[model samples]
Target: MRPLADRLAALLGPLAVVAAVSFVSSLGIGVMLPLMPLYAISLGASPVQLGLMTSAFSLMNTGGQLLAGVYMDRYGSLPFIRVGTALYAAGNALIATARDAVSLIAYRGFAGLGAGGNLIGSRVYIAQVAPPERMAMVNGVLASAASAGQVIGPAFGGTVVELFDLRAPFVIVAVTSGLAFFGLLTLPVPKRPAAATQRIGAPTSALNRSVVTLLVANLFLTSGFGGFITTYAPFATELRAWTMLEVGLIFSLIGAGSVVLGTPLGHLADRTGRRRVGVVSTIPVAFFGLAMVLDWPRPVLYVITFIAGGGLTAFTASWFALLNEASPEGRKGRTFGFVSALSNLGTVAGAMGASAVWQLFGLPFGLVLPSLSALLAGLTLLALAPGRP
Candidate 1:
């Protein structure tokens, strides 16, 4: 067998290209995430409208993955990625020019189409090129790169927003996505077996049943996590009167923790087993959620968020590895696509649920809901015991 380094170097040219595209695209999305509520409020949007706008973006993102997966599986990865990035660039440009909440929501939904396609395409590309044994490590590297983008995007977004206007971030996102489009052009095209053409059979009910259960569990976990992030800065502002810059710093720290912990944890899973890593990682994630609900001081909250971020990344890397391992060979692309879509559903639910709770009970209670959700998700994983017969 070729050495791991040799295998990696052989794939690195394409992998790095894809990772850069993914990173820039993700950075653009992250840059806009924290600013959404602020922008909505400025546009005189009601709380319901704000929730709808966020949900709309996620719903389209979730729904679009299924279509993207089919297309990629049938045609190839590069074509879809190129088209997706272009759409994303267009959507960002539209968002920059949006004048009303409705326009913003519409534009965001368009962007979600690109986001969904790009994400699935990137994963499929990685799986196609990387050797099976080294898949986890490559995924870890991709996750870390994406996390790094999340770290830089917000701080950069915040700076731009502070200096220019909300539109500035979207314009910057458009430019980055355009760059990603060009980057994807340099990669190799995936080859498909001519006989194995794309076709729609009846849904694989049995496979979907098993996969859907996992997806729902992921949704709950994602929801809890998404809810926490969605509400976190607001919670800090209400509790400690922190400024946007301070909130951005705190968020960046969380991303940094993910970047730091993701690869080592991924390696541990690969060496040991995915189930072991899943179980171990879930514990810290649960506690991190609990800690966030405890009304700790700013410093304490920061530490807790970092720990939570680490645990979250560990769990995600292991969980994805498990999913990849468990999926049927022919259906792997669809399986992952379904999971991606479901996870986005969870994010939307989590964000909406947290927003509602915050309005009803307050920040503390809202935050507590996510902790409870995470705890429940952890329990479900323990019950399922993936990677075992």
Candidate 2:
């Protein structure tokens, strides 16, 4: 018999081309993420302006994902994926030349559209190909690949900035995106599931209680996350007295944890129950947020942050697995789209709101809000999500 590693390799071999493309693209995005807040500040943005930049990205990201969801079923995922990737690359290139915050924000908005399209396209493709019982496991493999890029990207971003300049990283990102685009060209067009054909006459999925509740929960969940990412870099640098290198390393740590833990956790969720795992996964993230506010020691913060990544991966694996399974045949795109829309909207709100709180109240309250959002998200999930026991 083939060894487990061999078996798993064979399973993923067919997906390697697409997965490689995703990794390259993700790496490019990862390289820019850690530096983004600082870059905005360099462009003379105020804290609120930084929030606006992030919100701009999230706004278009939400719209693009929602639009892609509406059309992916009819037009297919490949087109959106291809175009989105190209646009994202272009956005990075534009950012490299950005002379001011206004231009940067506008460019980010453009990039957000690409983010949305690529996100939904890849998700639908994954759902169609995943074996029913192995949804989380399959997603785990993908997450691991993406996180590997993220692990490398931030670390690389820091080194490149020190070695050259901030513009250099953005330039590198543009080049990598082109590589991903070429890789994507090798893909065969995706076909909808045979099951979807069989259900051709079935009605579109309605926004029932379970679906609506799930969306709301996701919205709350993403909002906290959105707020944190936008605010964190600045806080780390100005208040925490952490160097940019330290911040970069921290992001790398998160990514590294995701790469290390994503697959194992997914398998665990599959066996233990996706919903149960998802519910449990929320605890670490909520704690991580609150811990940050309370000024946990740096070493402890690192440990919690790493654990938070694992929790997030577990939650994501389970959540997507559940979403895909519960979706009506022929409407998976729309279902995922709706969830993305809500989630990204939450991101926009979180980023904006967090910025507002930090500007007005202080950093402690800035941290407090996200913690509350995350806690509420889990509570909503526990009470109302499908498979509640």
Candidate 3:
């Protein structure tokens, strides 16, 4: 236990710095989530306008990630982080100042670009610095931080929104992001080797195709999840008579489960083959989406959400492990950037698709989309047997 403590302590400093930054950034991103639709409605935004705002952010977030990856590969992580953090701060400020729905949508897209930069840069930085053996642990820790941020952000944001106004969350996010910018300055910038034969533009076709397939699967699954997340509050308000606090609490439950289980699952991913861990863990994970569709009692909903969060961490840990292992040497930064972007793409598709479905057919059909998405993700993983990799 002493030795384990020492090892964790040694890893904690750098990990903590990155995690802190991730936390603040994620908090900023998530703070507005529960309030977005409400705020838009207050601004006289039509349902279609609200949907467009969410879709715009998803699209920009995905596109920004791809660009961030290429830039990080060419330049370095530190520059991107600095620039991204600044953009995030700026975007939050814009959100605070937004006077109408159109402006809100435009500003959120700017915020999405910043988010893409921060997320991709952080992942690439972790992959570059952490020892290969400890990659899963580090990734898990980061994921946990992200989950913590997601959990806290909504609760905090809800309070801020209630206390002050819808714009209050944006102000808080701007401040938090501002602090993270300074925290990031303390970390050492990793040096990129100039003599390596592989340039940033090389094709990734020959690398582990299985890993790519898994990432695509994740994109599909996440898209569905994103759609549900964006619309869940609205559905609950309309269908279940849930308040903002209740919605925040439900989301927090999901985050808490991930924070608790993420590191252990990551360690397991390292000890066990990533592919095996992913395949085995996805069964229960898919059920979380199904549970939502089932419309279980509130207590049962919490249990299912917890289970789903655990499954999410397990899936993410293994997926990160596989991505790191499969990436070509010297290109992990770019590879991860692309993967990050792809996940955002999934969010865009999910949000837009779900919103459109809900607009047309109502909440039940919208819920079914995510449920089917989880099913497809599980089946896709099963089809890509580790033996093929």
Q: 130-165, model 1: which lDDT tens digit per residue?
A: 766666667777787888888888778889999999
lDDT of 3 by residue, 242-347 (tens): 8877876767777888899888887887776666767666666566556666777878878877867776777777777667666776666677777777676687
Q: Give the TM-score of candidate 2.
A: 0.82
Ranking, TM-score, top scorer first: 1, 3, 2
Q: Which residue pairs clash in candidate 1?
A: none
User: Which numbered prediction scores highest in lDDT against the true structure?
Assistant: 2
Q: Model 1, clash count?
A: 0
Q: Which parts of model 1 have CA positions greater than 4 angstroms off?
A: 1-3, 36-52, 99-101, 191-210, 230-247, 295-301, 351-365, 383-389
Give the C-alpha miss distance for residue 80 in model 3, angstroms. 1.0
C-alpha RMSD of each candidate structure in angstroms:
4.2, 4.1, 4.2
User: At residue 198, what lDDT does model 3 achieve?
Assistant: 54
By lDDT, the candidates rank as 2, 3, 1
lDDT of 2: 0.78
C-alpha lDDT of residue 345 in model 2: 73
lDDT of each: 0.75, 0.78, 0.76
TM-score of 1: 0.84
